[model samples]
Structure formats: C-alpha cells, structure tokens
Target: MKELLKRYKYAPADQLPSYCIPITVNGKTCGRLRPITPDTLHSEEEIRLLTEWRSASGEWFTTQFPVTEHGTRQWLEQQVLQADDRILFFVDDEDWNPIAQVGFLHYDEVKKQCEFDNLLRGRKGRFGNIMIYALLALGEWSIRVLDLQTGYLNVLADNARAIAIYKKLGFQEETRTPLVKQVEGDVTRWVVAEDDDTGGEAQRYLVTMKVRTEGFYETLKQIL
Candidate 1:
C-alpha cells in the first residue's frame, strides 16, 4: 500500500519479477507498479477500471479476444487464484490512486513466457511511454532478480503503435501459439518474444540482421 514513485525501493515477494515493485524513469518517480491482488483490489479506482475493462465487450475486445461477462469474470477471478499467473501490474498514483493497468496475462511457466496484455491509462500522450518504461524496468528486474530467462507477448497485428514499442524494447515476432483462449470470433494470433533462450541464429537475426548479412557478404567476397 505504499506509494511507489520516483526511485521507490520496494522489492517483490518470493523474488518473482511479476510482483509489485518500485520504479522510476529519468530520475522522476514512476509510482508503485505492482500486481493486482485482492489486497490491492480495494481501491475504488481499480475496481472502476476492472469493471469498465470487463464491460468494454467493446469493439476492441470483441474484435481481439471476444468473450462473455461470465467468461471475463472467470478469468478475473482466476487472477486471484492462480499462483503462477501474474496480473502483472496496475499502477497507482502516489496516493494509492489507480492511473493505468498493464500486465502479462496467460502465463506459461514451463515455457517461461507470458502474454503482455491489458494496458489501460486514464491519460494520453506520454502515458504510453511511462507504462512502457515501467514494463522494461520490470523485465530487467524480473530477469536479474527472479532469474526468468524470457518474456513474450501477443499484440493485435493491427496495433502498429504497440508493435513498434515492443520492437523498440527488443521483442521480436515469433511463431509461438497463443496462450490466451481465443473465442471463435477473434482475429488471428500475433506474438512477440524476448529472452536468453532464443536460438542462436534467431537471436542473431533479431538483434543484428544487417551485421549477420554483412558477415555472409564478407565470406562471399573472400570466396570471390
């Protein structure tokens, strides 16, 4: 319940990277970025967002991962029950006020990957950048502190902005199957990955394709 802002020193329980942690960006306090637990669910603002996100059966959800109220309720209820499943984060302002929510849902422990989904911010513009910075900070914290080797996400293929951001953060297109159950009406799967376990060639291609191609070019040059 502590306000996580600007260089907050809080650490995660059980050393899991997905738990709530302190984060800051460019020397400014970013506030407490943590998992959405029943304990933290008491906030009115949090409850409001949860309700709206559920009711939003709007065009986005309908087009992306359509489901009924019952289905959505079941999933939200499970967030509190499943041990490995992390409601990754719903950030609050300094006063325990909910600002935006972003987290990895549908976690697959065996694969050490999860889908980075559900980001809702009340404000616009720089809000996206703040949430993204927070996510990367958590990624590093999870990797170094929790020993997680990889993270993955599924973005809406049409979401160019989000795709660009994930790419900028080093997530690459992947063929991994969708972890979330897609209703019959949903769209095709689109996924991305970041990890220590990427195949050597895949990693090379992802990290520096030009360099790899240049190496091949030099080899051919030498042959010629």
Candidate 2:
C-alpha cells in the first residue's frame, strides 16, 4: 500500500492512471474520480470554482475562513499534491466535467487505516446522488488495491445528512467529541473543548466513524 501510495503521489500526473476509479450506478458510469493535478489547476477559472465550493460548504466544516483562489491553489500545491500521505480527486461526470471532490488523507501504513476527507458536491443536482457511488469507488480502491484494513471519517455530529450517507456506506459511529469555536483574525476553527455535558459555548460535536475493509467491496456491491 505504501508503494502504491507513493506511485499515486510522486508519479507524474500524466503518467498516472487517468482516474482513481469510475463510479457506476445501475450498470452505467455516472462519474470518474480523477486525481487533482497541476493540469487541473492550469486555468484560473478552475481555481475559482474550487474556491467557491469550499466557501459554500464552509458551514459543515470545522474551520471557516474567507476562501480565495490564491489560497486554494496554494493548498492544492502544498497540502495536497506535495503531501505523501494524502491524495485528492475531483469527481467528474460522464462528460468529464468536474462536479465534486473527494479524497483520503492521514494514511497510517502501520495500522493500514486512513481517513476519508474533503468530500464536497461542488455542483449540485447534476449527478443525482452520484457522490455516494464516487465514495464507494474510492473506498473499494483503498481496501482492495491499497490493502487498507479500515477507513474512517470525521463529520459534524449536527450534519445529519452527511451522517446518514456515511452510515449507508457502512461506517459505524465510534466516538463524538464536543467542539468550541475559536476565532482568530479572519479564521474561525472548531476545537475540542470538553465533555458533552460541559456545554457552555460548545454547540457542536465531531463524530468519528469507522468501516472495516473486510466487507467493503461486498457492501459496495450490495449498494449497487
């Protein structure tokens, strides 16, 4: 898995696979999961689109800040493309138009585990629940090809829609931690504050969920 991850991370974007996987629904390809590359950010418009998605979806995230194209491109280069343990993919429709983004991060080679990160439907109502299949595709590849033992994700406990989707994908809730918003300058980040009962300014809880790799593919098949 480490070697494969290295290839995905270090290999030339053009040389790597065109897509991480193709998402299928009802025996038809609905979208493709393409890794974000330099080519993906070649155009200023592309960067702006990504920035818009992040800004629009900020409410569901722990951190909220004014998103800018400069910041977005910097993050893509330093935090994503340059990182060895993380890989981000843009979910493109059948026509190859990017509609969403999903990826895995914080890979633990020793434990064969990783966290599902940055799932956002940038363009809504275009694919019609295709994000679920896109997630399943990534999860399957992570387990079958990358040989991961478990997959995990952290979601805002108040995000009922996202929580339901994760549950449908076979992730079981493991823990929930109370969070308090900390504001500094233009950024506001939700930080772990205290126990669930010590409610003062902490209004949100972060929920961690896990899914075993053993029956991951089977679960995908069942869903499909």
Candidate 3:
C-alpha cells in the first residue's frame, strides 16, 4: 500500500478504491485518503461542504471562488480533472465519511515541480496533525514516483499558524510578494481560525516556499 501511493497517478480512475491511504493525527483517527472518484465529482453534499469551508477560510484562500453547488463542481473539473492533476479526498477510514479535500495544482512534468493547492482541513480542530501527515506523505510521494525534484506552495505570510506548520514539515521560504488584489466585491473584513493570529489581515504577503526532493524524505524522520 505504501509503495502504491507513489504511482496511483497511473491507476484507472475507477479502480482507485483499492489504493486508499490511511491518515491519522496524534494517534487519533483523522481519516483515510484516496483518489477522487465519479461520486465526488457530482456529489452535492461535497460541493456544499467545500464551498462553506472555503468561504469560512477567507484570509487563506486567494480567489473569489464559485459558491453554488453546480459552479463548484465545474471548478473542480477544470482544476483537478482537465488540469491533469491528481486530487485526493480525505475521508473516514471506518465508514468512508468525507472529512476534507486536497490535491496538486499545476504539476509540470517537464519542470519537475508543482504547486500544492486546495488543501483544506476538516472541522475537527483537535486532530490538527492531519495536515502535517497529509503534506508529508504528498511531498514524499511527489519525489519518490512522480520524478519531481521540488515541491512548492503559497501561503499568506500573515497566516503564522500555517507558516509554522509548513516550516516544521521542512519547507523553507524562497520568495515573498504582495498577493494579487482579491476582486471579490467590497472585501472588507475576513475571518480566520486562529485567535491572536498575527500577520493575517488586510496586509497579507503571498509567500512562496519550497522543499527539495531529499528534504521531503528527510522530513519524515523529523516527524517520526
């Protein structure tokens, strides 16, 4: 199962169920992660959940995304399906309950680099370690099988909590710039999860960071 995760990109989309990957946080049940399927592509419930969660996480997300269920599904197809990216769903290991969603964005096979995107955490805050494990595994898999030499991701510079987590996972700052202006109508106030979370407000930096292929595998040692 461990080796299979690195090569699931070639698996027939319909046969992805057999390649499910287990994920846990703090030794507690977080969920199982598997490749996206036809069910997730059309499920209205998932559409609602992702839309609501993205809206709630205003300061973190970049764009003014689609809000309606149909619109969200369309966006998913463009971003994950047509974009040649592998999207995975975070679900309960026992009963197959949906927990969250994550995926690679703009993975350039020739460049040997990719941007990680759509990584939203579930509502269970106490089991926060889920993000760490998810990212660690993804980073390892990227280098191990995808022939990737580097992994890149962007985060709000003001999002200290997320930045800290990224650092702990062995990602280091590579560049920083102001994020493109959000075109959402009358954007005034934004909501975030962390209380007293500094550096996340009207003034936000679009920080780009990366972890080398070797560093990704090395991170596993730190976490373990």
Candidate 4:
C-alpha cells in the first residue's frame, strides 16, 4: 500500500490534508518534505516570528496567533493554489505524522527558475532533522525534474539559525535589502545554483519574496 499520514483534527480544522511527495537521495526514497501554503504564507509571518523569536532562543511559541482557525484556512487556500504551482512538501514522522513544511514556489517553465518559499518545522514534533533532509533532497529533485535555473528563499536577517541551515544545504547569500518603510530592518536573500558547490556559481533566481500582510509570521509556519 502507498504510505500516508494518519489524519488528526485540530481547532476549526477544515482544510485538506497536506501533501507528501517522496524524496530520493542516491536513488533511495530517504524521506519527504512539506512546503508553505497560502494560509500558511510567511509574507507576514517572518516579521511577527522575528519579533518574538528575537526575544527567545530555540523554537517554541511564546504566545498565540490572533487569527481564527477557519479564517486562516480560507486565506491559505486562496494564496497557495495557483496555476504553474506544482507543490509544497511536508515531512512526515515515523508514524506518518507531519512535522514540517517547505514550499518550492512559482515554477517558471520558460525561465527555468523556481523559488523556495517557507521552510519550517512544527512547534511539537520529533522529526525536525528529517524535515531538513527532505527539504534538501527535494531541492535537488526540483532542480533535476523541474529543469530549474536556481532555487532560493528570503530569510529575516536576524534569523541566524535559519541562515546557517541554508548555507549547509548549499545555499548562499545572493543579496540583502531593507524592507520598505522599516529603517535599519532588512531581509537577507539567499540563492543557490543547482550545482553550486562554492556557494556562488552564477545564476539569477527570478522571484521576489515580499510581505503581503502585517504581523503574520508567528503562525505562518503552521499547517492550515
């Protein structure tokens, strides 16, 4: 039988079950990864999470998000589901429990470029590293199967942990810029060429990571 995650219901749970795609490394299906969604979009979450994330170290929620479950579900569906969008992968646990998600967004057939959106682990889970493994494998698959020019993500400058993780996965800083209207605040943009080994192989990933809503980062990593 094809493996699948056991369903679990939560507050106002109304969205579809998250997707799972097999990830192969060295010709073996080692794991899987979950991607970001519309309701789970980080355009705003990055900012909110940074506010509290800065105050604390490690991963754990200090407070609750302001939005309702129903509202969040509706919003994510609209934002994530679009033409030319192929996938978001959620890495599952040993018992087939989802623990994290990462999105490889805006697949451009003509330009051969796809952007890496959100990559986050659950507040409660045991397979955090599995998710990272899945994401890295997925990135390689995305490059080969999708015929991508480059894959990338925009991370908050202060998020040293995430930046470090990306670097280990063969991503490098392509550029950094200030977020509009916020003096002294900026987002570090990380980019990677498919075969990039020295960090800067030469290719422009065509995608703009932007904040679409205010204060949406805290819960933006959650599965809707």
- Which is the leading candidate under TM-score? 2
Q: Write the residue-wise lDDT of candidate 1 on 12-125 in tens digits.
A: 345433445665566566665766654433445556566566445243331345445545445555653353455546665545456666765444546544555666555433
Report the lDDT tens digits of candidate 3 across residue range 1-224.
22333345345666776666666555644556676655566677877886776777755766554456676777666655554554555544345666666667666777888887777775653454666776666666667667888888988888898889889888899987654353556454333324235446434567888988778778787675
- Which clashing pairs does model 3 show? 158-199
Each candidate's number of clashing pairs is 6, 0, 1, 15
Off by over 4 Å in 4: 1-20, 23-30, 34-65, 123-128, 180-224
Best by lDDT: 2
Q: What is the Å distance of residue 176 in model 3 from its true position?
A: 0.7
- TM-score winner between 3 and 4, please give it: 3
lDDT of 1: 0.49
TM-score of each: 0.57, 0.91, 0.77, 0.54
Candidate ranking under lDDT, highest first, comes to: 2, 3, 1, 4
Per-residue lDDT of 118-193 in model 4, one digit per residue for the tens? 5666544443455556655665555545556566676656667777666556566766543321113332223343
How would the candidate models be sorted by TM-score, starting from the highest?
2, 3, 1, 4
Better of 2 and 4 by lDDT: 2
RMSD of each: 12.0, 2.2, 6.6, 13.2
Q: What clash pairs does model 2 have?
A: none
- Candidate 1's displacement at residue 124, Å, is 4.1
For residues 1-224, could you state the per-residue lDDT of candidate 2 as single tens digits?
55566566555666755545788888888778887777756778778879999999998999999999999999998888878888988888888788889998998888889999999998753568988989988987887777789999999998999999998898999998888878999999999886653465567889999999755766787898
Candidate with better lDDT, 1 vs 4 = 1
